[model samples]
Target: MSQHALLNSVEHSDLKVITQAGAEYGDNLWFTPTFPQEFRAVSAYYPIFFHKDPATDTFHAVALFGFTHNDNLFLDGDHWQAGYIPLSLRRQPFLIGRQRFKEDGMDKEQRVIHIDLAHPRVSRSQGEPLFLPLGGNSDYLDHMAELLETLHLGMEDGQDFVENLKRLALLEVVTLELTLNDGSQHQMVGFYTIDEARLAQLDGETLAELNRRGHLLAIYLAIASQSRMRDLLARKNQRLGL
Candidate 1:
C-alpha cells in the first residue's frame, strides 16, 4: 500500500527522489492513465486506448507502452526511449491532495502537494532533493507542484470528454491480436476505442459540437495512434531476439 502524507519541509527536508528511468524506480508499467489534452503528443509515440475500471465501471484513456503486464518497451536501461512521457507517469511519487482551510470564516478546499514516502523513487541519498539546505522548496519541488496542478485539471477535462463520447455512442469494444516473428500469438481484450465508422456517420451538427468541445481532434488522434501498434510489436520482437 502507498504510504502517502502531506509534504512538509520540516519532516521531509532530506527526502530525495531518483530521477532515472528503470524498473528499479517503478517504471515497469505497461500503460498509464492519459487525458484528451495529451492525446496529440501521446498518440505520436504510444497507442492510445480506453479501458474500463473494474472498481468504478468507468472508462479511462490510457497510453500503451507494452503488450503485457510488467513490461515497458520504452525503458532501455536508465533512459526512456519515447520522446514524450504521459503526465500521469511523469508525476510519480507526488500527487495533488485536497486540504480544507478557513478563509474569511468560510471553509474552502485547496489543492496541495503530497508525497508517497514508500515509493521506490524516494530515497535519502543520491537523488534530487525536495527542499533546499536553508529550508525552502527546491526547484524540483516547484516544478512538481505545477505538473500536479496541470494533471489535475487535465483529468477533470478528460472526464467530460469521455462522457460526451459515451453520450454520442462513439465508443466500441476492440480486440487486438498480434503475431510475433517467432509465430507466437498474443491477444488483448477488454479495451475500447472510437468507432471510426460511427464517427464518420456523425451528423454535421454533432461533429460541429464535438469540434467545438475540442474532442473531435482528440478522437481522431486516438484512432490514428493505433498505427503505432506495429511499432510496439517490433519493439517486443527485438527484445525477444526473434
Candidate 2:
C-alpha cells in the first residue's frame, strides 16, 4: 500500500528522501521506461528494447537492466554501478499528478508533484531534505521538479516516436536465448527490436524524413545498444563466479 499525497510545504515540510541505490529502496528492476531524448546516454550503458502494453497496446521503450525480474546486475551493495541511471528509476517516490482548475473561466489541467510517504526511500530523520528551513524548496526538490518536467516531455515525444516506428514497420518480435556457465538455460520473449532489413529497404524519401525528424539516430542507437546484451551476460557470469 502506498500513501501518496500532493507535496506541500505546510504539511510535509520536514520530508526527506534517500538518494542511494540499493534493493532495499526498491531499485532492483529488470527494466524501466525510457525515451528517445535519453537514448544516447541509455544506449551507452544498457540494452534498449520495446515492450507493448497488453491492455493499451501502446509501445514503450525500455532499458534492460538484467536477465530476470528482481535482478539488477548494475546494483552492487548500496551503489549503482552504472554511469547512467534511467530517469524513471531516479525519480522514485514522486510522480506527476494532474490537477484540474478554472483558469479564465476555462477548465485547465496542470501537473503537480506527488510523493509517496510509504516509499522505502522516504524518511524524516536521515536523507536529503525536501524543503529548506525557511519553507523554500530544497535543492533536491528543485532537481526533482526538473526531472519530472524532462520525463513528462520525453514521454510525450516517445508516443510519437513509437507511432513513427509502427508506421515504418521497423519493429519485430525477438527471442533471446542464453546459457549460463552453471548449465542453466534462459529465454526472453515478447520483446521487440528494430528490423534492420526493413530499415535498410526504406525509400530515400522516408529515410530523409526520419533523419529530418531526428528519429533515425535514435533508431540506430537502439539497434547499436543490443551489443550490451553481452555485457549483461558477463555481469551475470561474474556474479555466479563462472
Candidate 3:
C-alpha cells in the first residue's frame, strides 16, 4: 500500500478498551458517535485515548467517536478580576468535555470501538454546550502511543529498562504518571526501538551512521520496520488471558 494509505491505516485502526478505576465509572473508555449526521465531527479522523495503570501494571486503551456538548469540551477563554484590567488574561486551558457512549454501561460497550474522553464528564443539562478542540486529529494517539511505550518499559525493569531502551534506539525518553477518571493511577514511558536485522540489511551504511547524519525520517522508517514493541506486550497479555 501507499505511504498515505499506511498512515491512514495506522491512524484509523480500532482500539481496545479497558477500565481500571471506579466500577461506577462504567466499562470501556471509548465513546460512540452521538450525532454524526448533524454536526461536524472533530475526533473522527483519529479516535483513540490511552491510559496507563502502574499500580496494577496495566494499559487501558480505547477508540471513540461522537459529539459532546460545548460545555464539556476544552475552550480557550479570557480571565478578569474585579479591577479594570481585562479578565480574559486570567483564563486557563483545561479539559471540559464529557465521554459520550452509545449506551450507558459496559454491556454494549464491549461490542464497539471507542476511547474515553480525557476530560471531565459532560452534564446532561440542556444549557450545557460542549466546545471541541480545532484539530480533528488531535495528538491523542501520538500522546497515548508515547505514554504506553514509557509505562510498559518502566514496568519491565524500572530505571535499568529506561537506560537500556535508549541504548537500543535513537529516541528521547520520557515518563508520565496519570490518574484516570475513576481515580486509578498509572505510568507510561516513551522511547523508540529499532530492528537490528533490518538495519544490517540496508545495503548502505549502518543505522548509527544514518542517525548521526540527522536522517530522522530514514531512522523512524527503519525503526518502524520492526514490529511495534507495544503490540508484543499486548499479545503477551492475551496469551496469558489477561
Candidate 4:
C-alpha cells in the first residue's frame, strides 16, 4: 500500500491510536496529524498494532505494526533504546523508539513524499513512498520474509545466534553505506536505517553476512519474537540447522 494509507487495529477496526500515559497526552502519528489527514484524503485504511512495554522505568519498546506494510522501518523494530536518558528530553522520546516530531516542530518544508530511511521515527513505518532506494517493491518482502523465517528458527534453538555474534565479535559500532536507486550514497551508524527499497538491492552474499552477523537477524527476531512468527521461525531453524 502507499504511505498515505491508514492503519487500523484488528479488534477495534479503528485507526490505530497510541495513548501515552502522561500529563501531556500523546496521540496521532509521525509527530503530525498528517497521517490521519492523509487517510481522510484517501479511502484506504488497513489494520495496524501499537504495543508498548515499559518494563524498566527508563526504557519502553513501542512497537507499531501494519499487516501489509512492507517497509523496513517496522522490520527493524528491535533496535530500540540504549544508554541513559539524557538531560535534553527533546530527543529522549524518539531515541527510545517513541513517537515525537509533532511536538518537536519539524520542518513543514519537508514534503510528505520522499523517503527517509534514516528518520528517527518515520524510518520505521510503511506509509507513503518517500524513497525508492531499494528499487521497486519487486522481491523485497519475499526476501525479507525468508530471512525472518530463518531468524525465527535461530531464536527457537535457544540461542539468539545473531545477538551472540555481535557480543562475541564486540561489534557495537558499525558504519552503514547505502546506495540509493539513483546511485546516491547515504551513510549513517548506530541503529541506522534499512528500508525494503534498499534491502531489495542487497545481494544474497551480503544478506547472508548480515544474517550471520546478527545485525539483520536481531532486527528481524526483535520484531517477530513476541508473535506467532517466532514459532514459524523456530520450525524453519530446525530445518536449516540454524
Preferred candidate (TM-score higher): 1 or 4: 1
Give the root-mean-square deviation of each candidate in angstroms.
0.9, 1.1, 20.3, 22.0
Model 1: how far is 140 from its true place, Å?
A: 0.8
- Regions of model 2 farther than 4 Å from truth: none
Quote the positional error of residue 185 for candidate 1 in Å.
1.2
* Number of the candidate with higher lDDT, 2 or 4: 2
TM-score of each: 0.98, 0.97, 0.18, 0.18
TM-score of 2: 0.97
Ordered list by TM-score, greatest first: 1, 2, 4, 3
* Superposed Cα RMSD, model 1: 0.9
Over 86-174, each residue of candidate 1 has an lDDT whose tens digit, in order, gives: 99988999988999999999999999999999999999987899999998999999998999998999999899999998998989999
lDDT of 1: 0.93
Best by the lDDT measure: 2
- Full-model lDDT for every candidate: 0.93, 0.94, 0.29, 0.29
User: Model 4 compared with the native: what TM-score?
Assistant: 0.18
Model 4: how large is the Cα RMSD against the reference? Answer: 22.0
Q: Model 3 over residues 134-209: C-alpha lDDT tens digits?
A: 3333354444344444333333332232233344443332343434344555554432233355445654444455
Name the lDDT value of residue 74 in candidate 1. 93
**lDDT tens digits, residues 16-40, model 4?**
1121222222221211111111111
